[model samples]
Target: MMRNVAILGASGYTGAELVRLIAGHRGLRIAALSADRKAGMRMGEVFPHLRHLDLPPLVRIDEIDMGAIDLVFCALPHATSQAVIASLPRDMKIVDLSADFRLRDAAEYRRWYGQPHAAPELQAEAVYGLTEFYRDEIRAARLVAGTGCNAATGQYALRPLIAAGLIDLDEIVMDLKCGVSGAGRSLKENLLHAELSEGWHPYAVGGIHRHLGEFDQEFSALAGRPVEVQFTPHLVPGNRGILATCYVRGAAGDIHAALAGAYADEPFVLTLPMGEVPSTRHVRGSNYCHLGVVEDRRAGRAIVVAALDNLTKGSSGQALQNANLMLSLEETEGLTMAPLFP
Candidate 1:
């Protein structure tokens, strides 16, 4: 039987990507799509790239009948997702692509997001949706919180090293470059064509980015102690993908072996041959994460780089990945589409 799914805030970048990916899914059907301000408009009109597929017209959240939905994918904005989800049926399986349920502690959520959580109980119950590290938890969870795209990319580089105690926890660093779509389809002066096309600038420097909260929570829990990674994010002028370069204190070969062993069974994360670097163009538009490792001339340092499509593996694709586990569907079903390359 085909399970019907509802996509909230479906007019945004991740939401549209969800529709795109779901178009290939055999066990699920998009039964509802909601876009508040764009209500009554066709998804085709809001995003012409999705016009060819036949889909339900966009509607407001209040107008949707959730009783018919077997699963819900919340692609709404951070603060907004909490309120919308709090009102959802308790039995509705959900995969949230927002920051609302990602943090385990409401106080931590308040500290990082500058506001109190609207749904603390849900926060406590939600499973961290990394898909790889938290796979078992996700399979049993009714609600799964997707990791931040940048956080997801950086963790792919460092998680195995941290778990295996192969790197210096005190000297970890991550420099991330993300394409414009990671910012979603919002209207921003900085995201403008003339203003951004020829320029690349770093925003949220000095450990101030919200994704740091995710890294702090996840890494610390993994290390069984406080683990902090200095993270700085830069916005590149392209339209998709995230490339995270991680610096750690470990042998290059050892780091390569650790990452390879960790993801050897993972369908989406690929550890490339040692000394080989990955390009964002190679994983663009697909739910694949490519990682590369190299040794610095300095005897004790290794450079690990990981790349993935922020819209896919980072956000929507990841959301779908978690949803598959929650629904008892094939883990890689609807996600086996190969990465798009030039």
Candidate 2:
């Protein structure tokens, strides 16, 4: 039987990505779509790439008849998904593609987002949706929070090493470059083509990027101690992908073995042979992450590079992967499309 799914905030990039992925899914069906401002419009009107599929007309979340929805994918903005989800039926399974439920502590949410969490109880129940790492938790979770695209990329490179105690905990640095689409489909002064085209520069410098909280929480938990990394993210003029280069104090061979062994059995993660690096272009539009490890000139140091489509593997596709698991369906169903290549 096909699981009926509803997508809230269905007009955004991640939402559109869900629609695209779900349409091809034989075990999942899109039964409802909600987009507040874009209500009454066709899905294709918002994303022409999805015109080939038949989808429900966009409506407001309140209009959704949750009784028929076996799963809900909330692609709403940060701080918005909390209240919106809290009002939904308690039994509805959810995969949130927003920052609202990613953090487990309300105080941490406030510290990073500058506001207290709207639903503390729900916040505590959300499983962090880094599928490979949190698969068991997500399989039993009523709610799953998708990781930040940039954070997800960085973690793909570093998590295994941390878990295996193969790298230094305190001396880690992540330099990420992401496509503009990771910012969302909303209009912004800086995102304008006139302002962004042919220009690339770093924003959210220092330790201020919100995703750092995720890195801190997850990495710290894995290492049994507080772990912090210097993270700097830059906005590059492109459509969809994130490339994270992580610098850590570890032997290159150990780094390779750690990552390779970690994701060896996982379907979506690909660790390149040592000395070869990944490119965002290689994983574009697919739910795959490519990782590479190399030795730095300075002994005892290694550089790890990871790449993935910020929209697909990072957010929407990830939500779908969890939803599939929650529904007892095959995790890779409808998500095996090859990465778009030039």
**lDDT string, candidate 1, 1-342, tens digits:** 899999999999999999999999999999999998899999999999989999999999888899999999999998999989999999989999999999998999999999999999999999999999999999999999999999999988898999999999999989999999988888988888988998888999998999999999989999999998998999999999899999889888888998999999999999999999998998988899999998898998989999999999999999998998889999888999878768
lDDT of 2 by residue, 58-174 (tens): 998888999999999999999899999899889889999999998898999999999989999999988999999889999999999999988899988998899999998889989
Least accurate 10 contiguous residues by lDDT in model 1? 333-342
Query: TM-score for every candidate vs. truth?
Result: 0.99, 0.99
Residue 165's lDDT within candidate 2 is 92
Candidate 1, residue 40: CA error in Å? Answer: 0.4
Predicted candidate 2: what Cα RMSD to the true structure?
0.8
Among residues 3 or more apart in sequence or in different chains, the pairs in candidate 1 whose N, CA or C atoms overlap within 3 Å are: none
Off by over 4 Å in 2: none
